[model samples]
Target: MGRVNTGPSDPTAPDHHEQGNPVTERVVAELVERSNTLGSDPRNTNFAGGNTSAAGTRTDPVTGGPVELLWVKGSGGDLGTLTEDGLAVLRLDRLRALVDVYPGEDREDEMVAAFDHCLFGKGGAAPSIDTAMHGLVRAAHVDHLHPDSGIALATAADGERLTRECFGDRVVWVPWRRPGFQLGLDIARIAEENPGAIGAVLGGHGITTWGATSQECQDHSLEVIRTAERFIAEHGRPEPFGPALEGYEPLPEEERRARAAALAPTVRGLASTDRAQVGHFTDTEEILDFLARAEHPRLAALGTSCPDHFLRTKVRPLVLDLPATAPLEQVVERLGELHVRYREDYRRYYEEHADADSPPMRGADPAVVLVPGVGMFTFGKDAKTARVAGEFYVNAVNVMRGAEALSTYRPIDESEKFRIEYWSLEEAKLRRQPAPKSLATRVAFVTGGASGIGRAVAERLAGEGACVVVADLDAEQAEKAAAEIGSADTAVGVACDVSDARAVTRALEQAALAFGGVDLVVNNAGLSISKPLLETTERDWDLQHDVMAKGSFLVSREAARMMTTQGMGGDIVYIASKNAVFAGPKNIAYSSVKADQAHQVRLLAAELGEHGIRVNGVNPDGVVRGSGIFAGGWGAQRAAVYGVEEKDLGAFYAKRTILGREVLPEHVANAVHVLTSGELSHTTGLLVPVDGGVAAAFLR
Candidate 1:
């Protein structure tokens, strides 16, 4: 027997039982624990890819009677973090009966409807498509996983023979079949025939194991993995030589990031049809090692190791020979041509295998992109999805590598891949997803986003479907802010003191690399130095100008250059202040710089207008809440200067405005969104006042 590596040891002792509903609770807990065990390792599962189930009992909501239930992981639920609610309960008997009534033709639509009808309760979630297979097995617990170890064997040219040799008669081997009612029926028949079999290895799919309890099921699954590992260890071929690159040295971190930034817009544009897509570049050792191999092209062309991966990674990746020093324009043009070719090839593949009954297929866009000298870039409708796809492809690389080491790697035929790719059931998952936000395809780069108006703008942009880069002088705070604004692939944090041109350039590069270029730039980073002209030293004036005036200029210049290179119009909104128009006593340092920055915006608008760039400014007063400067004692000091109590300062500013409303960071953010969203497309080089109708600060 092979030993399993169960990962880090838990200091706490394991609990054997749960506190509620004895059997149901215990089963659910076991399912969760074991699923987490498998899922904690990406080599086992990616995102919400794999599934598990347990047989239990539930009261039928309609009949108010007991019903045999199969609780299976539902759609869009991650196994690693699964909960009771994530597992949908369905009538086991009803699910099994569907197999007998399932028509010979593709009945995915009917099967899904039947599954919905067989729910044990009114609001019960939809069960996995493999729910029937779980019901057919005699065991009380079952798990179907896409672990890399098992897939390495499963995708081999003679996987069945290898599996039989590895496990003797303990495991059953089933040929490739579409996952649905038919596959469920086949699994049941195979289990019945192979009595005492611990699991079934499905060709080009994954492994399924079952037992009386979750522990037994987990043990069997691990045992199968160990067996495959041992088999590969014994029969593996010599490692292939890597491609020769005479003078190729990995680019420095800064240069690599810059290259990614320049390449992102092109990748996003090529991947997009109606809207832009998010792009993520991953350069893990596994990806780099795989790409370095001489035989990478042949192995990568073999398709995904499993059928389920088709939905996330597509059938094949788009391979590019991107030299580190390639010109951005040339790279864009080359990718455009390759994209057209990729689409044409996909159409041909679809037509060759798609039957008249098949549902309309999605556009032929490559999800996984491979750049020989750079890294692997994955594209998705959003950042989270792109990250998920990238992770899956990385796992695929490991699996393929192992399979090749053992023998010739093979995957399901193109016809089978086509069925799963275009399956109504698979496509329904995407269809059922709620529509993305209006700014879904756009990316925004916000400076000083750790707090204040910058943070508000970041949150607002993410809410509207734009991925964001939260740039701040404090790296730790920036990352924390990014975490708070988390919406999977939506935001990333980068340390940037906007005063430094190098830091400003890197921040923009990071944004481009994270989300495939910048469509929106919020130049909101600034500092307030409250002092009389006599008290304000040369240091104070330089610091204020560096951030407010020079910083804004540098960031805007870099962003506009990227936008122009992409040939896509973009928006740059300068977060100026009411101080820009109305000077405050002892605030010359802040007021003078703000005034300079406002004119800089107009100058940029004039110069960049020819390149389809829109530059505008928003001037707001008295946004104390969550304002960094205010929180740093400026609020109290300002109140003292105005001869008002600190507690009454907010009210004072509110009543000072004609609208009698407190100006807020969100209000300023709203104004920025309006200009960036093209609601004011015809308007630019104008100042919008967000100071609660302040007459002195009003734009005429």
Candidate 2:
């Protein structure tokens, strides 16, 4: 690293962080506001894909003298949600001193720890790898971003000449270099060497811009991106990817979605061969167009250039070789063969790169998979990770388009990519994440999840870290329930009448699309028509059994197929009622249906045990409060039958139990969690009673 001599610190600098320094406070606030404006749009930067900084004078509490402070985005934070607390506060004078003892690129890892000594106070947040970039730059504000249009130019074949043509003298081109303390020093020199330059394109990486003001820096960053985009548009071929394959032409929307749903579980399973993973599906025009073209296989094989994208999506995506129009059965079978080859190739890549110091081959499985016609599916430890991985790949696809238009898409070599993928610093960050919830990475599909016991079950499972699907007859109510559970990515709602086969399949498909495939299924959709045998019409009998009995049957069958295809063992819990065992008056239709479901649980458990599908039941007697059945007038009818007030029916049922406790939805939810909570992995096929000790319904 070339030594950059620093002058003595100015003790008389304005204290930006003074208790009453409004100007300094305004500057930091404006810095955050600029970051949000840029980060809010995916075009500006992908989620958590960039860092920004501002330099100002701050009062040193210990010395009572003014000092220059550098505030930059910290490690593991997204720019859009960045706050003052999210930035690392460092003494710029002390930071410049590190150039004297950087020890070169070979010892870069040690430099990260060395940053601790330069903290201005306790240090707002952990300093990121790009800290030196902001600190060494000779500007008041700096922005380092990875926009698609900019990276497309960065990875072009003749990028140096093209960058000159694109931005003239304002934006310069720097050769490919792995990011580190030295890379920052290199950028600093480039900025100093070139006068009247606003930014420089980091070859094979991204773009960096600087300005005397925060607004100017932000403007330069956006202008660089928009300029490159316009250049690519003007000079690039209309169809850089070439003609689409015969059978790979983008499938019709409905068919495309159906095929993606059918294949998601198998794909998710393949990705999880190394560790359990959730899946995310995407079929944007760009991704589909790329996959349909002749160049996709070759381009995808080259892998992504930017480290931010590669870390999330891995070295390269695993591609499906057969045509999209092939028979579903044939394609599914062929996928297995191709998957074997992909695994072998990935393992070889690891063997080719590993050394004594390299982290153990993290996993051979690819994080992203591309299928022509159908679309892209990405997997990770949880829903958010999976979704974000897809977003990063979209960035990768955009980079490819821009690069191909300029010339050949030339990304950084694979050897350097391997080093970063297994970098020790990244491993440390993973270790720092809080322990996962009990049901982390598991997907739970809850039927009738809109209200009552089903809603409670969904909420409880979500709290334990399971991604929930609120499937119910009421679409709006289902969405409401899902919203309360968590964010759209964490929990989703779908209208599903479990008794309809097509509707049931579509609901499960949504699950596969939203959070991979099902690991836990709650067959809880139900209704009741309390009537005596003579009064129970044929319609009444059919409706009751269709939901509880037939609906449970349909959901289990579809879930079993998905789970079996995934090859990951799963749990299925049926919410049977206490009436299944104990006969109740004027309840012929509802009681018989419950009895049918109770038996189905045991029968399926015995048969599906070979496939590692555990089936169980939760029998709750009088769940009246917040109960959809009660609210629908069942409480009045049951109260009339028991000779008690409508509201007192709950008390009447509770007094009958040995424990004298009214059964609530949460109580039933707890039983469901217990059955599938992994603590009782061996205890399946057993019916757990949540009826507060009803002897009549107790098993022998």
Candidate 3:
């Protein structure tokens, strides 16, 4: 490397001149704040001490030539409170070019020449060691802080390599070197190479990344530190630490159950994961208490697990005990509001970067770090969870320590960070694998498959490689439907009235004989009566119940028998209706029968949960759009019953949901697909809302 001369003065001394751009000003300001904080520390930290700088193009009013250098603290000044005037500018390109071809020679002369080339910006001090690297970040705003966690990681042998192995694909890593123009230029080159990289791990240094906005840059920094902390926790050798948090306890069972039922779906919607570790710390009393028992006490030693956690949980948690002066409902309500805000912000971010090929992935959590007395909670979707929290705690300590040991830490710039945050390529890597398409070769029987949702579901199941038997009231229609299914080798059509036990039993036998053994059963065949509650006669109720409710019971019992006899777990899907809960107009008989379907599915799920026979229901909201039901003026009747104009029925019905779109047969089919595909192996007794946002209206 070319010799880069250093002044006897602190290399990171600040400059008084105003740098162009608001973003740059803000970044410089944060650096100044960080520097002031560090200087105040008694240790008088160096590289481990805080450092700050400005990079990217600034047309020199005098020379018009771009002058780039890694800027840092000048000799005598404590960076803790260094202002722009304290900044020292240097020429980084000159130093890097010299290092490119040193020819195993001494570089003292080159260093002297480069030093002479440095500009003091009219009475400003000479550039710091960080000038060169800072100059090369290419982002208008660049802030570097030595988080303790990063320092610890860097201090380890092969820290750079290890960091790379942990966060390699997600972040860039650069080798450590003296903080100067040569290092800055080399890092700049790396930044240039990775135009989309959000941040980088400085091999033995810190982290560097840019942003179009300060918040974006800050977010990048937080994410990088969090990722590093997680890595160290998983891979770093563990040393004994104090106890885990004391007085810290899991949420009470009743409150937890109530909250989970009300909020977990929202959580799952955001995080999109079934497995989660939720630790509830009621008060600040437990924040430090956990350290005594924790495997790694260092994580608990700090106020926030890591620097970035400040964004999620605000530095530290609030401490409290039970008898919480606040009402339970009030606490829950506040948490719900926070969740909404978090999701809204996340959505805004998505909208800003969404494109045709890659629409943004929506997260369900409100990202609040729940602190009861100090109410806060974090929602992690995908892999973030507490995993990120634990990692951030440890990594921040490591980096902070390292930065103090040296003089500064380095990371990628903010613009680069933004790119990575919004990168279509990176986003593609984080998608949840799709639910399976079909139930494979599992055999299924769909009663009333001649038409409607049952037929549609049967077609879908058949398409998914299921051996489907189309059982219907009309034998000819059943055979025709089977022929249309085109699963000649796997599907068979049979005539049977589901409400008739003998007929259903005979059909079951024929299907089992045909497909070896039945594995799935769709209890969909049904009849409906649209009488008022007072108008609903006993006979009407009996017919609807026997067809919709009892039929499901009998079919399920037989299917379970077959599944258990074959010693293979199976899935059962029931076709229910939104009317089970949402009473629409005067259809008392239909509503009553539909409610029974929901109960049947739930009962089956509860009974068969141990038998390994999963039961689920698809409560179709409005499948009339592409069906015979729609053409028969049912919409008009529904609109009339709901006291709405017929012309605005779809929009009226749609108003009940957040998605505001009419439910489609395919949408219902998709839900069925999940239930039957084994993707929902752990899911049972659940009613998945296919209603755009209608259910949400009532839920909120």
Candidate 4:
């Protein structure tokens, strides 16, 4: 292998000099462009794992004196969507001084404090722990990342020699060392010794490349990755392992999704804590292929691809069996035992490696879960974090494959992993996160959530920190609603016709799978028909009953079943109608079914009370906007009956109510939220009227 110039020759890549001040424009712009390009690709970086920096001169705010400044990626920031404010600026001289005076003991804490203290101005973000290392390099720009290709070679036993063979003297090699002031000093020493080297590969960690300009820095990083890829392709190639499932036929798409949904709750329950949001991931080809490997269980337990991955993925993944045909009860029992063993193993691992100074590990729960037959599942405090963990593990699998193909897969030892895992700096990043919202760890499922009252409820629940599954008759609308309710991996969209029992069951499965389990369910899907008793056709009556009455029964039944299996008490809120309590002229079909649905809630509450499940109903009237019924010409029909114009119908209902306030979709959502929030924990089997105080609808 030989060093080859693979600089920015692609015409399609975005130019970095498009925006910013003249002084730092090229450097800053190039950093942003390259960072986004690298960060956007999961193979390059996951979440906020990578760091980049640029050196420039800025006037000192305190003394108005010209000072050299290093802008480094800030802590807890994502590079793909980074902005100017995301980079923390520090005086280069102050950072270098810490290198000379800082004691090695408690280096992590001291370096973090020193970084915070050396901020160029008030309110500046904290620089990454690698900031000092970025300053030591003489280049105008620096890029540090944990790309899969680089990690594959970095974790190999002969990685150092191979790196030298690939790039000759173009890149330096740094032995594994815990990241802190000492690591920074070591990197500086290597760079000084090899003045001609443009980059350095840190064994068992990652790679760093620097240059006089942003373009050169990015080019060198890309070149390093290319050389590693080429070397792996030629020398270290794995024999063909055959197709992922050579003997077994793949499950149909629908069946696969259904199986995932059924098994998701078990993973979620095992991974969750009292205070964590705990989002889940179970559908990906990479995960399936990894699971299909004959040595999957052993290979997955080897370790993470790199040390930085230990912070998110842990030392090894927790492997479990999830056959598609496994009984739910059996699956639950096995998962319970697996969880216990996993925790014990984690405890033992920590005990064996921990020093007297190490802080007690917070929790021993597994972040990545490998389900042999079904696929892989990753858990996090929220959807985005869970997805990030999944991404890292997927990349880990690829890196491991590459390493095994070339040579024995060799990662940092457990002691080194413990150092990074329990490092105060990494832990502080998590600590600095703001307190979670009220419904942080809760999961909710909402039917008809694509729009109207359902959509409002979904959004409100998500805002309060619940992972939500938006189910509707329209798949496109459901997906859109889920996207709008976005918090990476937290919300999912499923097309579900509530009246269909199979569809309802599938939707519930999806809810369980995506969020580990469902805590709150909103039965808000229904249609309205206005017809006199004498004029009502059998089809009209059946359609109304199937949806409002039978639909509620099916959804509630499935939700209760899952909740029962989870052994956790949950809330079920049914969206009934004010007309259910008060008779409305020419509305027999809609009103009668709604009344039946309301009574069903009381019956369910009575039956489920023993299981600690609460069933309640919300009676909302005259929700003119954001209502499917209203948008489907019900507003005009109701207005005609009242001898008012279509546009005036909303006002007409408002005047008829005792409070004379407009009843909106949001008003209904607030009532649903209250019931699901367990604020009225002691109360159940009741209906809350959210119709601006309708007298007849009031509970007697």
- As for lDDT, the candidate ahead, 1 or 4, is 1
Q: Tens digits of per-residue lDDT for model 1 on 1-700?
A: 1111211111131323222457557767788788888777665667787778877664555665656667788877888888777888776777766655677545555786788877776564577777766766666788888877788778878888888888899988888877776676677678767878998888888888887777888898888877877777787876732464432334566666666666776777677654467778887777766665677778777768586676789989987655546676777777888888888898899889988877876778888877655677888888888888888888788678767777678888888888778887777777899987767878899998999999999999888888989999999999999989995487889999988988888888888777778888999998786788898899999998999898998889888877876666788999998888986788888899999988988898899898788889999998888899788887887888889997788889999889999988899989888877757788879888899887887665
- Model 2 — TM-score against the truth? 0.97
lDDT comparing candidate 2 with the true structure: 0.89
lDDT of 2 by residue, 552-612 (tens): 9999999999999998889999999999998889999999999999999999999999988
What's the lDDT for residue 334 in model 3? Answer: 60
Candidate 4 accuracy as lDDT: 0.78
Clashing pairs in 1: 383-489, 384-489
* Model 3 TM: 0.37
Tens-digit lDDT track for model 3 on 426-541?
34434534543446546678988878777888888888867788999899999999999874555789998878888887787666434445667888887665556788799988
lDDT of each: 0.78, 0.89, 0.56, 0.78
Clashes of each: 2, 1, 121, 2
Candidate 2 backbone overlaps, count: 1
The Cα error of candidate 2 at residue 174, in Å, is 1.6
Residue-level lDDT for 222 in candidate 3: 64
Check candidate 4 and list the clashing pairs.
236-406, 265-516
Score candidate 4 by TM-score against the native. 0.91
Q: After superposition, how far is residue 290 of candidate 1 from its true place, in Å?
A: 1.2
